[model samples]
Target: MPRKVLVAYGTKNGSTAQIAQIVAEVLSKAGLTAEALPARSVTSVSSYDAVVVGSGLYAGRWHKDARRFVRRHRRSLAPRPIWLFSSGPLDASASERDIPPVPGVRRVMDNLEVTEHVTFGGCLEEGAEGRIARMIVRSGKGGDFRDFTAIEAWAAHIAEELAGPESR
Candidate 1:
């Protein structure tokens, strides 16, 4: 049976959710059973063999839901293979270079046995919520900076790690 992987994310404007979906798709294509869901919607992590948790970076902190999810499920999550991701850089900096996890995320990593963590570029389109998001969009600084190629590659690496050498 294929390993069941859950890709859970906390997103305010939906871009981070899109990234998580891409991750799940890549894992599924790599022969694992993967599902992506909003982090707040997940009631339990015990059913998944591995978990990928991601959150939108806001003010250098993870979204509240992501933080709560981790704290709520820490016990169930600690023994499982885990990966993490953050999406929120309004520029090409993320694609051009590695962006370390924000401090809050780093603390979470320190508490958990995270196998890997990645930061991807963010997206802010016309319909984004919040005053600052609207202001950024109006100023034309908000656009999609997500590198799908890089996102896919990262997910594939996770799959290969979870699926064993035979998967390669």
Candidate 2:
């Protein structure tokens, strides 16, 4: 059977979900069978050979459901290849340092062998921001900063890593 992978995400306003979809698409194009779904919708990862989990970063934290999903399935996930990502930071100024999983999240990642943890720029649509965020955006700092080229590059790299020697 072909190796199967799951690309699951926890999102608010759907930016991370879009990123997850693209990641799954890239992986599928690279020769792996991949499925992208919401984190809450995935009941188990037992049948997947690998998993890619992502969440929208909010106030230096991952969405609760995404964190819980990993915590809930830690045992089932331990033996699989796992990769993590976050979509946040509305400015080009956001750096790799801004992307590490939050404290509670780090504890979960510490328990497993995570292949990679990436932080990608996110989008903030008009009227989607809270009061403070609106102020920030009004200050001219907010925009759809997601870099599709970088995103696709990262996904392609993941595809190569998970595709194995035969596919390579």
Error of 2 at 69 (Å): 0.8
Task: Kindly report which residue stretches of model 2 are placed more than 4 angstroms away from their true locations once superposed.
Answer: 94-99, 129-139, 165-168
Per-residue lDDT for 87-155 in model 2, tens only? Answer: 888887444445566676677678887887888898877676478667766887777878788788888
43-127: candidate 1 lDDT, tens digit per residue = 9998898999999998899999999999999999898888999999999999999899999998989999688899999999999
TM-score of each candidate?
0.96, 0.87
Looking at candidate 2, what is the lDDT of residue 48?
Answer: 91
All models: lDDT?
Answer: 0.92, 0.82
Which consecutive 10 residues in model 2 have the weakest lDDT in total?
93-102
Model 1 scores worst on lDDT over the 10 consecutive residues at 159-168
